[model samples]
Target: MPELDAEKLKENALTSIRLGIEDFQRSKLEKDQGGDPARALSAVRNLFAGILLLFKYKIAVSVDATGDASVLIFNPPEVLPQADGKGGIEWKPVGKFKRTTIDVATIKKRFEGFGIDVDWPTIDKLQECRNHLEHLHPANTLGEVADFVAELFPVLREFILTQLNEQPADLLDTAWPVMLAHHEFFRDTIAECQASWAAAGVPEMMQPWLESCQCEECGSSLLRPSQQDIEEGASVDNQDNTFKYVCVACGHSDLIAPLMIKELNDAYYDDPRDGGEADVEECNECKRSTFLISEQHCLWCGAELDYPTCTFCEEPLRQEDQFNGGLCGYHLHAYEKAMRDD
Candidate 1:
């Protein structure tokens, strides 16, 4: 077995960490003016590499009985201990060549064994985004890049400070301030946007989509309902029904109804042609596929629908089952049977 120096591995880990932070800082600084996509991509890739390297460093430093350092290497060769002639033992590798280093999965399992409280979901998210950006060009947006950093900051900060016994601010240096500033800005913006949505007085059914709403044109989620839109939404009987929201990021105006219809329908329904029950259906009055059966209202035309009954048998109908010639599914089936018999 080749003698591996623990100090060299540690140095490599530290270098990767510093370079990762520097890349991340560059990405954050250029975020406002539609920053370079390459910076964000590099930031994620370097940070992921740094994290894996740190994990490997931790594993490499752990002491073993034979001092063979086989545990640090993936698919490590079995070693046989023999007498070294002078009341000593020597361990030899089973294979002729050195094995590859442990991978991310192994690192995670080993961390769990060592009782490390790392937030692995955050790590996985970073890895996923990194792969997406590096392999698939322009896969993630700047907002997504900021989101990845914001979610990962606390995990990285905790691990570096508690596990590595190092001051993050000192290690990260210039990147530390940039990370903190970006996190605060990202958090406050989300809070403000959510607050504005809450005050918009959208219906209870539409609240979930409001939080995740994005501008279709620019894909920016920084949309806010106008004051007039809020007032109309609050009013119980506002016939005007013209609610508007503007994407602050893109300066684009869109009607809230169409956006809500698209989002809500996508969230709740699928094509009936695909053999799935459609949660939303076409509105009889508006001829638009914006009818929410649960709400019993056309989201686009404001047409309130009553629970449908079969015209022939007067039986209650399932909300999702479309009425065929004013007949429930049971009656429709019976009519079909009778026609076939005749």
Candidate 2:
């Protein structure tokens, strides 16, 4: 008799997204520390659930009966007769999301009809990853293919904004502390991955090394042998096996012996019940990655620890150690260089 409540569902949708972010941040920490990638799969499952809630919201606010019909299919119409025996039977609605054949296929087609451009190929791949995470033993390869999660955030956020006509900043504010922190982590993680690929310089030769090695500095499994014949930006200092590796996540390049590298790999992948946070300090501001207390700041978010003097951001150095310049490994060095050059 009464109409569906859109406001309440929207509130729930936002909350789900926040919860999903929390799960993802925690699991990501585990993966970065050379722990089991399987731990991160649970985060994927939870995030997908949050995404499904948004789909429900989209369907709930349809422009016409087409929307109701779409929902009606899932919420099957139950045949109910009037009080009088002679009265004809009328259709009663079932629960939400009960319509016939409700799935990725149905949702995609419906979104397309509304001129919403959802990325089907990426979504398709993610679904497969999610299935494996849910049903089979989690693999490092499975984690590798999950790059789509970072790509999907903007798209889904846009869908909610465009359909609901809500302001981005307002949704952002609603998302709050976690939203900003997650955004930073997602952005930095992707950038770190990209930099590693670029730094790989000799990919063809290093493929085997990458396949066998893991980068403890970045907790990345994409470690591979570096191209030894690079230009003499500087002469090799202690060139032994030339078996150095570059981590896509941390950009740490070292000329370690092959046997030493293998030992490091074992140490990195060793399973831990507490995600290896026992020795590392979680960021005080963002609470993302766990770093050594000696660092005095989180390597991921630049959040100060100990004294909390928090000068990391106030003085954004154009260069800090190997990092481009910024705090906690965050940097805008390239942009600053361009400004100076101009």
lDDT on C-alpha atoms for all candidate structures: 0.67, 0.51
Native-to-model Cα distance after best TM-score fit, residue 25 in candidate 1, in Å: 4.1
TM-score of 1: 0.63
Q: Report clashes for each candidate as comma-separated counts.
A: 0, 8
TM-scores, in order shown? Answer: 0.63, 0.47
Q: Candidate 2, clashing residue pairs?
A: 73-99, 73-100, 74-98, 74-99, 75-98, 75-99, 210-223, 210-224
Please give the TM-score that candidate 2 achieves against the real structure: 0.47
Cα lDDT tens digits, model 2, 1-342, are 224555555677677766655555554555566555454566677666666656756766665554464452253445554454566655554444542434677677677776766667767766776775566444443333234356456666676677767765677454445555545666776556445445434223223333444444433444434555244322222243354656554456775344343443343443477555333433445443333344455433455533322135543221123243233333355566668999
lDDT (Cα) of model 1: 0.67
Question: Model 2: runs farther than 4 Å from truth?
Answer: 1-5, 28-39, 64-101, 135-149, 172-180, 185-200, 203-342
Q: Which ten residues in a row have the lowest lDDT in candidate 1?
A: 232-241
